[model samples]
Every structure is written in C-alpha cells, then in structure tokens.
Target: MSALWDLPDYDDHEVVHFVRDHASGLSAIIALHSTHLGPAAGGTRFWHYADKTNAVKDVLRLSRGMSYKNAMAGLPMGGGKAVILADEDRTKTPAMLAAFGDAVERLGGRYVTAEDVGISVADMQAVAERTSFVSGLPAEGDNAGGDPGPFTAFGIFLGIQAAAKFKLGRDSMDGVHVAIQGTGSVGGRLARLLAKDGAKLTLADIDADGANDLASELGAEIVSTDEIMQVECDVFSPNALGGVLDDASIAALRSPIVAGGANNQLARPEHGKLLAQREILYAPDYVINAGGIISVASEYFAKTENREVDVAEVRERIAEIPGRLVSIWEEAASSGRTSAEIADARAQELIGRG
Candidate 1:
C-alpha cells in the first residue's frame, strides 16, 4: 500500500516523472493523467509541502483534475501537472527554474506547463529560457496571454451568476450576500466584480493585510478564516486551496449555493452525494475553474503554431463556462445525481475513460 500505485489519488496516471537537480536544489514531480485527447497540459505549482509523499499525492490528484478540467472545457488536450518542492522558506532561484524547464523539455512535448499557484509569468519566463513548452508568455494588446487571474475571476463571477439564478432565483448579485474564502488573485477580483453589482461581501484570507485592504476598497465586511464557511450567506465561494468541501464542511455550510474557482473542491467523490443530500447546488470545481486553463491552452496552442492568439476567441471560450455548469446542475436535478457526478461522467466520456 506504500507503493505509488497504491496511492488513493494515483488513478492510473500515465506518467509520474521525478526530477532532482542537486546543483540547483531542485526536486520536482510531473504527472500525466491522460493523453487521449492530446498532449497533457496543466500548470506547474511551486509549493512547500510537509513531505515527499504529500507532494506526490498532490500532483497525482492535481494532474487528474487537470485532465477532467481540460476535457470539460472542450479543449483538445489531456491533463498533467508539475510540482516543485520548495523549501520551508519558499525560496526560488533561476537555477531551479532552468532545471525544471529541462525536466519538462525531457518529456518531449508530452507535457505543457504554465503558471499555477505560487508560480508567475516572470518565473515562467525563466522556465521558457530553457524550453518552448511554457505558456502564459506576455502578448501584445488584445491577445490571449499573460497572467490568467482576471480571466479566472471573470469566469467564477459568471458561474456564480448562473448558480444564483439556478438555485436562488435571483437575476443579479444586487444585495446578495457572498462569504468568500481566500481573497487572493481570483477571490479578490471576484469580490470586486460582485461588489460592482451591489453584492454584500464578507471576505477572509490568511494574508490579513491584503484582504483587509480589498474589503476597505469595496466597502465590504471582513471575517476570520476559520469562520468564512459557516457564515450566513447566499453563496459560499472558496477561492483558496482544494479539498475544503468534505463531509463535515458540507454539513456545516450555511449557503444555498457553492461555486468557486478552487480545484477539486470535494475531498472525495462521496462528498458530492453529501452536498446533494443537503440540496446545496454545487458547481463542479473543474468546470467552474476552467477559465485559467482555457487562457493557458489558447496561448499555448497559438504560440506553438506561430499565430496571433485571438483575445476575443479566448473570451468567447471562457464565457461558455457558465452554460456548462448550468447544464450539469439541471441534469443532476432531473437525474437524481450530484453536479460533481454529472461533470465527472461527462469528463470521463470526453477523455475516453468512461
């Protein structure tokens, strides 16, 4: 049971490549979950984990999620993910980037990586110095490129709108209450978007200063991290890390709808059933969070083909996210299944794994 295949999150990943560069103090894992549609494409996450096993477990799950994400987004790519184990201090160096890029290059186009949590366009610049397989490169005006945060936030906002309409019968965010966890890139932007529509917001983050500043800017209320989920609100959006919507969390949720940009929101598949039992309208994370990958994939494909990436086209694809969510929600309602289950089944069919 200690073996890689025995890991609960493994899911028969096609490749799990480990890289170690002692000179650069680099240790990384790249996992490919599928290639049925095309080469595996996902982002590289540079995070500090407690141990190697946890890191591997994270990559395995993330890679599989990416596969589902890409498939659900109707992209011609499979899923893969890379993780660089950072030191406790989270120190990053150019040498480490170069070594990681080299590792990606060794895969020979089997994997494509862009920015994820803790990674940035500047860091991807360093990685691109060693490999052309990187995405999120800076583009000219009105092109599909650069950081994906705004695009992701936009999609989440749209999905929230859809969820609100489907679940709460509200046509607008006006006076709607949203309790948001993690007021970082996606969450903060989403809060601003909702505020523009007159949403009453309650925000929380581990980084108190940033969250406080954002709350001040939007004239929204702020709360503690430990209490965001149980807040009495119309929507509970988790824009932080994954695995927060487990059994106990679902039981404690006070919101009628759960929709956010976080990946793998359900800790396990069974938790989706728990949400259904509670009648909490769930937005499957992969479907709701595909905006980032949509931007990344559009940019990546355009870069490889020596063509100008159409910004409008990318936005058009991103706008489809809400419809997909609504489809799953309605289907689940009529079919007696969870939104997560419906989304997963659709993704599995797309990836040739159903």
Candidate 2:
C-alpha cells in the first residue's frame, strides 16, 4: 500500500534478493516472479534508487509487470528485474557488472537480465564477461553497441497510432499533438519518430540541454518536466522513472491518451481507476514497452539478427495495442474496474492455465 510494489491484493509470486560482490564490486538486486508463466526475465538497472527498499520494491513490481507484459505480448518468458545500486558517478568498474552477472548466474537461467535505466550496452558486455545470460547487444557491426531504446520508440510510435485509431477515431498521425516527458533514449527517439510523422511535439526532461537538443532537432516545443503532465496534448508519454502519476499529479494531467516507454508509470493501482474516471485512454506501460523485452528475449533464445527485426512485424504487433487497450477499456467499463485490473485478469487467465 505504501509502495508501488506492495500491492496486497494481487496474487503475485515474487522473490527478492540482495547480493554482495561477484568478482570485485557490485551491489545487486534480483526480483523474480515465476508463477505467472515460466522463468522470470527482465532488465538490470544500474542507478541509485533514493531508498534501497524502493529499489527492492521497484524490482519486484517491475518483474511482475514484466510477467504480465510478456504474457500479453505472447512471449514464452516470465518476469524478473535487477537493480544495481550505484553512486551518482557512473564511471565505475566493470567488476560491478561482473558481479551482477554472477547474480544472474546464481538463478541458473530461471531469471535472465538485460539492460535498462543506468545500464548500457557496454555494461551488458561487462556482464557478458561473467555470464551468458544477458542480451540486447546488436550483432557484429559498426552499430553493434546501439541501445534498444530506438527500437522501443519505434514500437511505441506504432502503438500510438494504434491508440489513436482505437480511442480517438483517427487514422493517421498527421496532426496529432504529443507531449513526451523525459527526452532520454526512448523519448528522444519517440520525438524523432513523431516529428517524422508530422506530429506536433512538446518535449520535457530534467536535463534541459538534452530536451532542448531533441526539441530543436525535431522542431518540437520545449516544456519543463514539472509541466509535462499538465500539457494539453492528445498523448502523454512518460519516459522517465516510475511512479510519476501519483494522486497529486494525476489530478493535473490533461492528456487524452497516456502511453510511454516508462516502467511502472502508475504511482498506485488506484491511479488506474483515477485515469478511468477521467476518461483518459491509458495504455498500460508494460504492454506498450515490450519491444525491448521482445528484442532481448529473441537474442537470449533464437540469437535472432537485429536486421531480422521486421519493422512491419514489430509495427503490426504494436498496432495491436489499440485492440488490447480497447478490450481492456471495454472490460473495465463493463465491470466498473480499472484498465490494470482488466489487464491483470487477462494475464492471470493466460498464465493460470500454464
């Protein structure tokens, strides 16, 4: 109740752990939620959470959300997440990542790790030095070390189109106004895609320079991070950290559709109901941001080539967002439930059979 991960009502199977050094340096957290489907798999974020308990809660909730996301995305993988507490200084040692790899190894393939947050492609390579349980690196090429955020943005772009079609009764992104908060890897690329599609863009980020750069590049207007939720736009995309849509902020949000690449965007389960009450077409963050998972999962199992990531196929999958959102919206309306409740019900129904 106090934390986003501490949802007492959900029947979740979660395992939370803290581990010390693996090779030399690293504080690691592994959260596994395996009962939802199969072995848990998620990303390793290397940022310093304000509180250790918050980090634990984030990993736990993110892992379970991953289970639901993977299930909804029709992936065979379960859900898990790793958070490595780091100082503000990112120029640490490879030993930290190696230690995280050891944590992954301790799971014996039941829990796999990739990259997220403060983790990067280079960090994955460091983890790979100790274990083979990591993914998201492009194959041998000049662009081999590219981040998966662009792909994620691409998928979200497609999903936004799907959302518009289903919720707004529009067919194209020609004049859609989108407010993207946090112009980081995913949000920056999302801004680019929206600009290319002739969509009006309003960008925001804690890093003013980063946001301004992207805004200038994409011809988007810039907004402050604090003003993002209140921006009058067709869609609101949160690409920053989790739990941004708390009660205080939710009341100020003026967007018609809310979707993005952020994990755990909802501050609480009740926020979903708040959105429903406001008639905001909210796409579940987990459901919309499955591209990175799909990419990494393919790498873990099939060793699929990056070029093989068919944009059309990915777009087709993302285009199903509207159908899924519509179903969840309808179910919520009929049952007087939240979209999250409907989504969790559908996910549990699928995983319960397995």
Which segments of candidate 1 are over 4 A away from where they belong?
none
Which residue pairs come into collision in candidate 2? 40-79
- True-vs-predicted CA distance for residue 8, candidate 1, Å: 0.7
lDDT of 1 at 208: 95
Q: Write the per-residue lDDT of candidate 1 for residues 138-210, one digit (tens) a residue.
A: 8789889988888889889999999999998999899999999999888999999999999999999999999
Best candidate according to lDDT:
1
lDDT of 2 at 158: 76
lDDT of each: 0.92, 0.77
Q: Model 2: how far is 150 from its true place, Å? A: 2.1
lDDT of 1: 0.92
Give candidate 2's TM-score: 0.90
> Highest TM-score among the candidates is held by which one?
1
| Per-residue alpha-carbon lDDT of candidate 2 for residues 79-117, written as tens digits (9 for 90 to 100) | 788888886675568666677777788777788777788
